[model samples]
Target: MSESNSAGMFSGRKSEGLVLVVDDEPDVRKVVRMTLEKSGYTVLEAEDGEKAIAEMKKDENSLLLSLIITDIRMPNMNGIDVINYYRKEWPSVPLIVLTGFPDMDMATSMLQHGIADYLVKPVEAEKLRSSVSKTLEKREVHGF
Candidate 1:
């Protein structure tokens, strides 16, 4: 990415930035999208890691992404792969891991990778909102 394009995402001009939600379940995606949209954030959906990467590559708005929330148990392309891709290509965009099967090792590893949050499945709406808010705030202050 170009320096100007990278700067755009962290420009801090917008009140809320676009977020990418990656999960195989449509219902989960819908809930996340609705929750985020209601909180004044624009959101995009992807079924898996591969699709998420494709969307980022193809969509113009993806360049404005401020956050990514991904589920770990997705088929074909899991959250680990998604995290790896993000850390490699867009490490400035903060990530959150939402998983049903939470493992200590995995959470530790993901946290070490600098992910913003690791939330368990069936997360409360308020909790999700709070996490997103806090993560975004941290990004603004820390730029990471």
Candidate 2:
């Protein structure tokens, strides 16, 4: 086999998904899209919870929505609001929070309110991949 084939070469096409990634930072969104796409996930984006919800509502294909990655502090509806909304509307959407500051109180509150997991800002690709994989594999996007 050629050297490229030895690595289990990746497919250029991303997984057919409509994942909602919410964050105020454009750079953060770029990184996430790049990472998730590399892992074969088609990513959807939102600058805040409101936009996220809007995107979710526009979702066709009844996409499984594999997961949602959001930032805790954002304008015009923070991650908390997004989590709360999904809890009622699309109860099956898994949420992972990314924050510049990861406080126990906030984490506890989110967990109590149904957040699947969290990550401190500057989230590494590996961490994102692992968290996403675990969440999707368990197919427990609704439990949180």
Best by lDDT: 1
Across 1-144, the per-residue lDDT of candidate 2 in tens digits comes to 111211123235546444567788888887888887777676777887777766765525225566788887765556577677666767777788878876888888888887778788777899988888887777754353
Candidate lDDT scores, in order, read 0.78, 0.70
| Highest TM-score scorer | 1
- Candidate 1 lDDT score at position 45: 80
Clashing pairs in 1: none
C-alpha-based local distance difference test score of model 1: 0.78
Across residues 55-138, which tens digit of lDDT does each residue of candidate 1 receive?
A: 788636566778989887755545577678777877788999988966888898889877899998889999999999999999
Which parts of model 1 have CA positions greater than 4 angstroms off? 1-15, 74-79
TM-score of each: 0.81, 0.77
lDDT of 1 at 99: 86
